[model samples]
Target: MNIIGGIFGIIFGYVLIRYRERIGGMLGDPAWAASIGGIYNVLIIVGIFIFLWSLTTMTGTSDFLFSPIINLFGGNTPPAPSDF
Candidate 1:
């Protein structure tokens, strides 16, 4: 739904923006519409890809990101000094 909505909005907005000159005869002017639509489309695409990539990459391996450092130290984490 997100992708579909984004695409639909982008297409519609692009059409209105790109044809602003022609549409000027009717609507005020859609200059910003084109650039805005382009920007929106780009943002949506980037966001969707990033989200999908992240989902597929959730390796549940907590250590895959940085546990090796803890393991290298033998996993015996020193407790912080007690201020009490």
Candidate 2:
């Protein structure tokens, strides 16, 4: 899925770069341009942060950072001992 997503991203980026001039002209209003750019930047930052955070969780650091949240949600308890 990651590979497929990366391929799609590359294709989409290539198309965007190819048609940037036409797209810019259509969105030429200063307010429109600013809002569009701002939203794009915010989403990119969030995506990068999520990817890096996932790496941390996969490496077992989630215990340090997420244990409280898990415990708060009642997810970290061990099973009760079985009676003989």
Query: Which numbered prediction scores highest in lDDT against the true structure?
Result: 2
Highest-scoring model, TM-score: 2
Evaluate all candidate structures by whole-model CA lDDT and list the values in order. Answer: 0.53, 0.58
lDDT of 2 by residue, 1-84 (tens): 555555555555555555555655665546544665743443454456555555554555857887888999999889899997
After superposition, which runs of candidate 1 have C-alpha atoms over 4 Å from their true positions? 28-84
Off by over 4 Å in 2: 1-42, 80-84
| Reference-based TM-score, model 2 | 0.37
List the candidates' TM-scores in order: 0.31, 0.37
